[model samples]
Target: MRFIPSLFTLAVCSSFSIQADNAETAIERITVQGDLRQQSLQQLAGSIAVVSEQDAKRTSAQHLDDLLNQFANVNFSAGASRGRYIQMRGIGERSEFVDTINPSVGILIDGIDYSGLGITGISDMAQLEVFRGPEASRFGANALAGMLNLTTKGPTATPEGKLSATLANYDSRQLAAQFSNSVNSQLGYSLALEQQSSDGFIDNTYLNRDDTNNIDEFSGRFKVNYHPTERLALQFIAHLSDQDNGYDAFSLDRNRNTLSDEPGQDKIRSKALALNADYSGLGFADFNGQISWLTADSDYGFDEDWSYVGIHPDEYATTDRYLRAREQITLDYRLVSTPAGQLGGSDWVLGLYVAGKDYDLNRQFWNWDLWQADSFSSSLERSNAAVYGELTTPLNASWSLVSGMRLERYADIYSDSSGNAIKNHDMMWGANVSLNYQVNNQALIYLLAARGYKAGGVNGDALAKAADGNLTELNSKASFKPETLYNAEFGVKGSALDQSITARVAAFYMWRDDMQVKGWLNPDSGPQFAGFIDNAGSGRNYGIEMENRLQLHPQLALFLSASWLKTRLGNYITLDGDNLSGREQAQAPRFQYSVASDWYITDALTFNLSLQGKDAFFYSDGHNARSKRYELLNARISYQLANWELAAWTRNALDKDIGVRGFYFGNDPRDGYEPHVYEQLSEPRRVGVTASYQF
Candidate 1:
């Protein structure tokens, strides 16, 4: 429980004897894509973390969620086959049901938005940047909590290729390949393909099957780059993915063994295309334009009863199914002036964006014993137009100011199968201001204040109707207010001992108004549960984070990262008149820490060890149940010879039983509806070998 002090002491002792050097290092000059332009990570006046391709390879992460879980102040809710929902600083959705949701965090892959559905396949990645706190000035409504920006490898002029395969415990297997080539002086291309399968950890006792919760996935990507002239560059990208995974997560005993005879399926198929152009022929600025299109079809269903009819003859066997198809198109145009050359001695960027989306959803709930069924269908159309600008100027030789703002107009139309329609529109804005000071060539400090917001929308669930059975009154209760936050932060980032040691420390405080909280409500006479969002009065959150990396010796290195957070609700009362004030938010852990070390035994052999831990936290706002704190230990050993490399790895070496997600409600009919806690556990200890070759 006292991980913060332990990590701090270790970092201090390791970095105390470092000597300052004048040589530049790779970490000091790392470029980050936090905004539209690329800048050194140290120059950014925010909290940011980056994971490189080399880091991904060393960890042997098969998906984006696996890689992200290693960082500080990050966690995932794993009810599905994989960790598809992400929570940062305790601000995100915990689960998704038969209703529309506005995500707090935003996810982008190669400039294409993938919010709410972030099943990103990890392959051929260049870098991934995680920006904590509010990023509304750059990303608008989707970034109320933060943003995750992912960049893939681009086309290279040299001909290169890679082939890799992995075999692991639990009958897991993976195959992947990548190739890049330059056809001529102006044309270059890159292609990547991957396929993976696994027999999941859970078992179904009634069906006598071990693969009820299995994994099968395939993904491919292609990119093309063309340079017609010195001032003009064009790039095209396409991606496709298919996934068919099982979802038999829960059981009567809250263990890995399930009794559901009718198992569920989690499937998704997606395609994306994008084109980007950059032209520097403008008189005083460079012009950039991008157009992108994406489509996804997903099916998520589950056996609601989690039991066979033979076991519980009196209870009705129930099943729930949902299907969704979505399409989106976006266009963006921007201009960036030459740095400190025009626009009144300040660097400026201006841009305009337009986007549209069409979404359709269908849900079916059936009870076999009673022969009762409820079917619902809905369609949603949305559009957005925004204008944003940023300006940066130096007030003194060591001090600089950065200011940015975004103004957006949003419109939505929702229609349901019952002939009920709702229309909503709003105009919102967000802003950011930061002042940074350079203490020396190796250190910098900054203070920032920002505002973020999420737009309101209509609810289409039939159970959301008014108790009075009045249509007009029902429509009035179907809407919720927008949520907003004001955040203030201070941080210091720098290198010490001649760039041999790097460290960053930050403290942040945030105030939220009109906070949106989601829960289910049961009416006095309804057979279905109604899901609704209410505007909670207010809340406050504060946290501190620290990270340090030290090169202790030529063959050894050490890294430590830790976070401490505090949260409190205010004036929020549930439907049962239960006061929620002073309660901690769900999924908001108090302490998280990660420590890693790497040793090079020889020119061809290396070893890595990592330990990570997360403190206990509440599972939901409607329940008092909490999860237990857990820790994991992992190790890897790799050997390299010419263009071939081999590695062996083990995760969760200590085999700790950590509960990643939990629900505190009655799930079994045998106990006569007595509520009990059910939990989904984290992955157990697994060992594997990976072999890769490059040319």
Candidate 2:
């Protein structure tokens, strides 16, 4: 599997010369909406990936997980129904059970912030933008490693509608609809709704149920645009998602058949509203502002024993569940200099941001033991305020200097039922400077330097439990120091061969101070383990990424992306009294790549084929377990005539055996409870068909 991508990439590149005459097809120009102002993808000085609506439809992706592998050096951790965390450049959380997280990666949907909440369904998404490096100056603390931004489809002026249906293996099914229309010249609106469900791949033999691990999700989005005047525009959006999924994935035999009797659930209910405004009525500058609010509730739990009562005579019947509720409010206002408002031949942007977020959690672990029915409740609140500014000045016709900075203040209050209370406050800042040299209309070269940071916090749960025993643990390690990273990068982006080929290349080196890493804590007496954050003195990560697109013919296009990464962890001591220094960081795969082709066979028929693969890496810190490297193949063919379309798709066509997550523990009693590696497998081969109608 590791040799596949090299051969595939070479074969595709060699054909670029054969179809020289047919290489006139031009690549589409893309706009980056995640930034303060809309800018061309090539003009932005960053490592980014943008997946358009058309590309998503071709892949038949209903969820964010489906498109994550298309980006270089991007990965997700699957500890629940879906991947609960997103990792970039070897940084991000793998799981969050008892601790409140200050995430290294940021997640945004539309005009609202969903940072640290993983991701949501993208049934009506317009595009997905993934920033691969730190965006400290633009995004601040939440984007220490990078960020994911999702934009939903907006309102339209003319009446249009679409209905789509899909069916697949494992009793998977989906139904969706989208419509847009205008009430008048000044008002327009759009709506999208979707429902998806499937009897998951797991088979719970003990419970005699195939749906013990299942998926049922409903999502909707609504948007309205009011353009009453030329200088003022207002857009309002509403978003909702309801999910009820089961979590019975892991097995003692490392197969799909599970023995858990008390299958747990992974459920989330969310509702949000956002109002965005753009006004040019002001004389000096144009204004862009947004106010948004979101409320979400989640229920996640699992059977701790992984077996029924009778299966293991000595095992206790226990289940762990977490019920949480969260609310977030944000206000962002910015002013961009108008053409007449430029100062000293420089353009500037000034903005202010305020956000408030709080969550309450209840953990109930029920067991047959009379005194071990542990019930713990906790709450955390976060308040943030920031002021940021950016300035770009031309140094000549072919060069420019860009600089930006952000100053922010954060306060957090946390408390729990164990008589433990903690308060943390930090005033931090981030900044970036870039020098851009535009060699010509077809190419731009840039050098950038940036600094990013992540706030420190207390490990409440771990600290409370440690106080109950005489374990040798240091108080200084209980609260880690704030993390900071200094990064330097060189990049180039442009098109070539008469605009038939577009490519972007970037190489970066980063140094981390007080790197935050998860440390597994084992109880002195019990098998229960807790995870907490600790400062791993220092670390370094360097990587190179390439994104290329070639217009082989008028009816065909090829996409290629690759990343090579190297990460090293500095000296760090674990809770169990072990030293790990100069070890490769977890989840930081050495190499990752993807190659795809989209071809229009005829006027009404199209075909797409993609192959993606990654190198194996360590699964966690303080362990030697690793996943096996693997490759996956996907293909789709669609035929359209008039307003009707039919498509058939298959993913992982070869049915390769691969593991997405792994754990090393002593869970199986059959072998005297000896520790062995257990893995959660990736999806096998799946085939499906889709039908769509538009009017």
TM-score of each: 0.94, 0.94
Error of 1 at 431 (Å): 0.8
Error of 1 at 316 (Å): 2.3
Compute the lDDT for candidate 1: 0.80
Query: Which candidate has the highest lDDT of all?
Result: 2
- Each prediction's Cα lDDT score? 0.80, 0.82
lDDT of 2 by residue, 243-352 (tens): 89998988878888999989999999999999999999987789999999999998999988788887765565778898989999999899999888898999899999
**Backbone steric clashes in candidate 1, count:** 3
> Cα lDDT for residue 562, model 2?
86
Off by over 4 Å in 1: 1-27, 367-371, 462-477, 523-527
**Candidate 2, RMSD to the unseen true structure:** 3.5
Residue-level lDDT of model 1, residues 102-217, one tens digit each, is 87877888888887677556768888988888788888888887888888887888999999998999899999899999999899999999998888888899999999888899
